[model samples]
Target: DGYLATFDLDEYRAVKGGVAKKLYRYTNKRLWKRHRFTIGLRSLAEEKLGFKQGQFESELARSLAAPVAELQRFGIVCVIKQHGRMKQVHIAKKMKRKEAKEPSAPVPSLAKKLLDRGVDNAVELVQRFDAERIRDQIENFDDRTKNGNDVGPGWLRCAVENGYGFRKGFKPSRIVAEEQKVKSEKRRKAVADRAREDAELKTQQAADEEAFAEFLKFRNSLSENRRQELEDEALSKCSEFERNCVVKARRNDEIGMFHQLLWEQYIIPTLAED
Candidate 1:
């Protein structure tokens, strides 16, 4: 099989960094640029040498000579080409085919072939091979009933269940019933999983609402002295100019409305109530 050979300069840098630095000046510059070296390998030499029409092999040979030759020792052949502005290497394994011989025994029928392959159920075997045929028969029966073609409901049901075949010892109706039951179970499990996720989300929302209500109650119950201590703490956290800016920014909407209500309804009333 064809395989890729990648020579990472980082590995060489870690192992023989000093020696590599001394050999070439471009080594350090190229390492800093993060360039990677890769080569393709094939088993067949002729395929590697062969070039397609309108393809140039000489230019590729000039670009990848020493590294390509080095990889050949490991049973690898290389083919390089420029695809657009980027250069690419293709590798392939040398494959050989064996001659064919005529069969000496008689060819078995489809039913006999299935039985010989250890599948003894005739209805199951036929349905597996030609599922589209059964589907077409069912669809045709549905169309006939829709167009008033005198097909009784029982007849359509029997045709669909038995899959349009009355072979001896074939029980397609039972198989169809089992297939429907499996589909129903899969749908039921999916619905149950969705219900479980929705229930968990609802419980989390209720808990968040309760926590917010408790925080509002605690803030409302502070004494006037305690409120003054909070105001002093807030003032100490920032300069007077920053506090004035915050109060000015909140003067347009519900935030300003809340600030007014906090001073009037809670702070002033609490001092009077005390």
Candidate 2:
């Protein structure tokens, strides 16, 4: 395999000077693989640049200033410096200005969809890639899986990870598609089951809250002595560990709060059972 350096040909053509042109070409070839490098001037002049005659290292370095400045205008940054007795050229491409990214507010909805479709660690994936990229992958995955023969969460995850449709000339194999379809169905079912369990838990919590509120009103309406008797009865029904909690609360002067807890945890469930 060989390294590939890509640049705008028009931009390359517009840069002035032989030194600048060769410097641009050299940096472009390497900068794609690495960000920065330092090359000794003698080797750079003789081996890389192919200058007609040998010049003093300092003279060669000074000559590079104009070319380096010209190259800078075309997106490369270069500096000539002395290292002991040798002159070295430090080179790197200028970083492009990044456009402001859209905020991550929309990530949750996109992540949820991916989660339902059987992508594991969906939230992390969404956060890492951002909503726009994930959305693009989703569209690509949907298009690929439209035939519905081998389709599932695995396929979608693979599509997102590999950039199946978006990357040039890359597609998932038939075997991979079939495997993903099978795995995705299982993952989707698991996700749906968890969603159902969560909904049931929330519904139960709401019902419990309503029941507790009703019981609180009834208890408050009782005479003070009757309320004390009801709290004592509930406390007696609690486990030894729960009893210790109440005792600790009482010591901390949070007895009233613990009494309410006793009613909610013990009395409420007993009332519901009856």
Candidate 3:
């Protein structure tokens, strides 16, 4: 943490002087000032959600109940106008720079959305979110652009949500239907592929486990001196890849690479011993 602690006076000055004066001077202080929000809870609620204000004892109070309850659940507001316990809520928000504008967040990354949706299987993943369909929509968008073509239905939503491309028009229902069909096909394919991969992996793991068991039996049958001799022999016979893996595994306590090598077929008994 203190990499600079040993620096000499001249070296310290050389490092300290690296930052240019103009870069520091150009930063705008005025832009950092607090933003003023003029809209209050009463007006903003009514404007955004169509909430209405009326006498607490009147029939209008019934209409206000649900909207006010929803608004106050935001934690930033408390609507108590119903019980004649109405209190004013002042909203203060500063607009941010272009990159910082708080629009509804774009769909999260595939991994994040998958985890959040608890989608582990291909069917679940496809049903919850159609990644392949999104991809096809992107391709369609590209094809249309290349030919100087008009935007298709579902093009606008697809472009804005995923591709960051823009088109202005009402989305077509047919495009959505086409997207659903493509996703359905992809899910079926993905499920089959995943099943095949899992089967291959399990078969390989079973073979490895059987090989490891054989090695362990051989090791366990040996005397203490014989065991040490075998361990040293195994260590000596390690390939560059095996040695590197063992060393790294020992270095990293988080994962036991050395123990893994001792069981793996890669570090089996020597030819003479076998």
* Highest-TM-score candidate: 2
lDDT of each: 0.44, 0.70, 0.43
Could you tell me the C-alpha RMSD of candidate 1 in Å? Answer: 25.7
Worst 10 residues of 3 by lDDT: 21-30
lDDT of 1 by residue, 26-131 (tens): 2222233233333321211214333233434454455346545533322234457666655555533222112222234443353333333222232343555455
Ranking by TM-score: 2, 3, 1
Candidate 1 pairs with clashing backbones: 42-77
Model 1 scores a C-alpha lDDT of 0.44
Candidate 3, residues 1-274: lDDT per residue as tens digits? 2423321222112111122111111111212233222334344345443445543333433444453343222111323333234433333223322321222444345433333322222232334546755444445555565667655322323242334432455233456688899999999999999999999999998997886676667656778687556555666777777767765665684334355565454335343456
- Residue-level error in angstroms, candidate 2, position 122: 34
Best by lDDT: 2
lDDT of 2: 0.70
Model 1: residues >4 Å from true position, as ranges?
1-171, 223-274
Instruction: Tell me the TM-score of model 2.
Output: 0.34
